[model samples]
Target: MSDVFDYIVVGGGSGGAVMAGRLSEDAGTRVCLLEAGGRGDHPLVRTPMGTVALLRTRLHNWGFETVPQAGLNGRRGYQPRGKGLGGSSAINAMIYVRGHRSDYDGWAAMGATGWSWDEVLPYFKLSEHNERLQGPLHGQGGPLWVADSRTGNPLHQRFMQAAQQAGFALNDDFNGERMEGLGAYQLTQKNGERWSAARAYLLPHIGRRPNLQVHTGAQVLRVLFEARRAVGVELLQGGHRRQLRARREVLLCAGALQTPQLLMLSGIGPQAELARLGLPVLQHLPGVGRNLHDHPDFVFAYELPTLDAVGFTLGGGLRMAREAWHYLRQRRGMLTSNFAECGGFVSSRPGLVAPDLQLHFLVALMEDHGRRLHRAHGVSCHVCLLRPHSRGTLTLRSADPLAAPLIDPAFLSDPRDLDDLVAGFKLTRRLMQAPAMAAGVRREVFTAGIETDEQIRAVLRARTDTVYHPVGTCRMGRDDGAVVDPHLRVRGVHGLRVVDASVMPAVVSGNTNAPTIMIAEKAVDLILGRSRAHGASMPAPVGAGADVPA
Candidate 1:
C-alpha cells in the first residue's frame, strides 16, 4: 500500500466523511480516511428503530463514561459516541436540526470568522438535499438526504398539538424564517433507513473514487510532526503500527471527545498538564481541551396505559412485529420513527434575546438515554439548556493513547444553569399537562410530586446529563488561547487543522449534527482556497461585528 497521500483525515465520523468525500472530488487529491471501528454496515445501523440495538451494545459505539460529576450528585454520565465509518450519525436518532441562526452568528461574534449565519447558511444548503422542504433556506441535489418522518405516528402530532395548546406556535420549518416553535423534525434518512454521513458522502463513491481510500479499524495513535508542521500520522491498523505520510495536511475530525485527546497526546496542549504526565511537549497551546461544554439535559418520564406510546410489553411486541412487516413492505411504519420526532426551541423566561432551552418530546419513556427500560407503555419530554454557562475539561487519564480521556462536563456547575433548567422544567410540565397530552398521561414517573424551585433544583441535580452535543474543546477564535484560528488551522502549527464539532466556539441552540456537517461543507472551501460565490458577496467582515437581530 502507498504510504503517502495528499490529505490524511482522522476519524471517519460526520466531519471526516465529508472531508474525504469533498477533497477527493478533485481526483488529484488523494485522501485517506481512518476509522477506528468497522464498516458500520450492520442491519442495526440501517434500520431507524435499530438505534435501540446499537445504543445497547458496544459493537460500534465508543460508549465512554464521564468522571462522576459533582453537579449530578456525584453520578457519572454516559457518552455513546459512534466508532464506525458513519460515526455517531449511524447510531443517532437521525433528527435533522440546523440549530438556530443565532448560533453561527454568535460564533462570528466570538471571533470565529466566516462562521456567521449569513456566511455559513450557504454551506448548510450546500450539503443538504431536502426531499420535501426546499427554497432559499434549503437546497436540492446535495449529498445528504433530509426528509420528514415517514412513521406517521399519532404521538408525533399529539406532541405538536400539546406544545401549541400550551401556547407555543406551530412551526412547519425550524430552519426557515423562525426557529422558536414546536414541529415535527426532518431526518437524515432515505427510504426509511438512516442515511448517515457515510451513506450520504463516503459509501456511494468508495470503489468509484480511486483517489479516496477508506481504512476501517485503523485507530490513529498520534500526529507525527516535523518541527512545527504536521507531516503524517501513526496508527494501529490490523494489529500492526503503520505510518502514513500526509503530503499536504492532516485533518482531525475525531469529534469533541477524541479530537482534543489526540491533540493532547500529540504534545499540543497545556504545558503544565503535559509536564505532570511526563510527556514531551511539542506545542504548549493552553486551549487544547478547555472550554468543554454540552447541553445539560433532563428527561421528564411518565407511564401511560395507551398503546399509542411505545414500550416493552406483550402488546408492544406485537405492534413492533406489525411495524417491522410494514417497514419491510412499504418502508413506512412506527419503525421509521426517530423517537424524538417532535420538539421545539423556547426561552426559559419571557423576552429573552433567543431561546435558552430546547425541548425534545419522545414517543417512549427514555431514562438514561434509553439504557434503562420499563415494561409499561410510556412517554418522555426532554428539556435541555441550550447555551450552558457551565464548562469542564477533557484531560488525559494516562499517557496511553488507547485509554479514554477524562471527561468532566461539570453539568450545572454554574448555578445559573440549574435556574434555567428549573424554568424549562416548569415550562415542559405545563406542556405535558396540555389537553392533548394530559388525555393519555397516566402518571409522572421521574419528577412525580415535585414542586417548588428547590424541588425542581433537586430533580435537576439528580437527572441533568448531556443531550449528546459536546463541543468547544478546540475552540475557533482570534484569541491567543484559541486552539484553532478562524480558518480552523491549529494555532502554532502548520499543515494541521481541526474540522469537527470540537471547533465550535460555543454549543448551538439545538441539535448539533447538522451544524457540524455545515462546518465541513464550509471547511472544504477554506482548505482548497476557493471562494464561495454565495458567501463572498456578503458585506460583513467574517468576524468584525455582532449581527443585529432583524
Candidate 2:
C-alpha cells in the first residue's frame, strides 16, 4: 500500500465509513481509513441479540466510563462505544431514527448553512434503502438497509396497545411525516442480520477497490500539520508508529468524545488547557470540547411471570433452545430481537415544539445497561430528555493517546432537565400501568411506591444516565467560538474536516445514528464540491414538519 492518499478518514465509525466509501467511488481518488478496533464482521456484531455480550465486555466495545458525575449523586456513568469499523452502529440497538426535521432547520438557523430539513433531506433519502416503505421521504436502492423489527415477540403488540390505552397516538413510521407518537422502531438490519454502516459502506468495497485501504487496530495519535494545514496523521498500528499523508484532505470521524480529544491532543484546543497539559498550541479554539451533551435517560424495569420477554428463568432456558433452533432454521424469533424492539417520540408536556422525551420500550431487563443479571423475565422502558439544556465537556485525562478521555456529561446540571424527566417518568409509568401492560407484570422493580414529584426526582438522580447519544463537542457554527466551520472544516486550518456526530450544534431529538449518517452523506458532497442539483436535491415532503415547532 502507498504511504500517501488523496483523503485520510480517521475512525471507521458511522460517519467515517460513509465518507471513505463515497469519496473512493471516484476511481481517481485514493482513500485510507484508519480504525482503532477490528474488522467488525464477527458473528457477535451481525447478530442483533449479541448486543448483550457486546455491551457487557470489551470484545468489540470501547467500554468507556465517565468521570464521577455530581448530577447523578457522584456516580460514574457507563459509556459503551463500538470499537470497530462500524463504530457504535456495529453494536447499537439498530433502531433507525432520523430526528425531527426541526433539528436540521435549527442547525441552519444557527448558522450551519445548507443544513435545513429541506436541504439535508435528500442525503437521508440518498443513504437509505427502506425495506418496506418508499416515498419522497424515504429513498430506494441505497446502501444502508432499514427494515422493521423481525422479532415475532407478542410484546410489541402489547406495548402499542398499552400506548394507545394511555392515549398516545400510534405512528407507523417515526422517520415519516410525523415523529410524535408511539410505535415499533425500524432497525438497521436486513434479512434478520445487523447491517451496520461498515457492512453497508466500507466492508463491501475493501478488496475490490485497489485505491481504498482500510487499516484496523490503528490508533491515531494526532493530526500532522504543516504550519496550520493538516497534511496527514500519526498513528500506532500493529505496535508500530506510522505517518500517512493525505494529498487532498484529512477527515476526522472519531465520534463526539474522541474527536475533540484528538483536536486537543493535536494542539488545537483552549490555549490555557493545552499549556497546562504541556502541549503546544496550534489554535486556541476554546469550543473544541465545550458543548458536550447527551440524552439523560432513566430506565423503568418490571418483572413479569411469563417467559415472553428475554430472561434467565428455568422455563425461559428451554424456550431459548427452541428459539435457537428456530433462528438457525428460519432466521426469526427472539434471537433477531434488538431488545429495544419498539420505541417512540413524544412531548413531555403539551405545547412543546417537538417531542422532548423519547422512549425505548424493551422486552427484557436492561438493569445497569444489561450488566446486572436477573433470573426472571421482565420488561424495561427508557425515557430520556431529548434536547437537554445542560452541557458538559470531554477533556484529556492524560497526555497518553491510549488513555480514556475525561468525560463529564454534567447531566441535569440545569434543574429544568430533571423537571422534564420527572414528567416523562410519570407519563411512562402510566403507560406501564395501563391494562395491556399491567396484565403481564408481576411487580415493578424500581419506583414501585414512588408517587410524589420529590420522590420521582430522587429516583431520577439516583438512576439517570445516558442513552448513548453524545454530540456537539466539536460544534459547527458561524460563531467565533465554533470548533469547525459550516462546511465542517477545522477553523484556522486547511484541508481538515470533521464529519461525525461531534459537529452537531444541538443534539437531535432521537437516536443519533441515522442523523450522523446523514451528516456524512451531506459532507461527501461538500468535500467534493458537488452541487446538490443532481440526486440529492429533493425537498422535504409535505406534512413532514414537526407537530409542534414550525
lDDT of each: 0.88, 0.90
Model 1: number of backbone collisions: 0
Per-residue lDDT tens digits of candidate 1, residues 236-264?
98889989999989999999999999999
Q: What is residue 30's positional error in candidate 1, in angstroms?
A: 0.8
For model 2, name the residue pairs that clash: 353-549
Q: What is the per-residue lDDT of model 2 for residues 236-275, given as tens digits with 9 covering 90 to 100? A: 9889998999988899999999999999999989888899
Candidate 2: Cα lDDT at 302: 92
Clashing pairs in 1: none
Task: Find the 10 residues in a row with the least total lDDT in model 2.
Answer: 541-550
TM-score list, all predictions: 0.96, 0.97
Model 2 TM-score is: 0.97
lDDT (Cα, 0-100) at 139 in candidate 1: 86
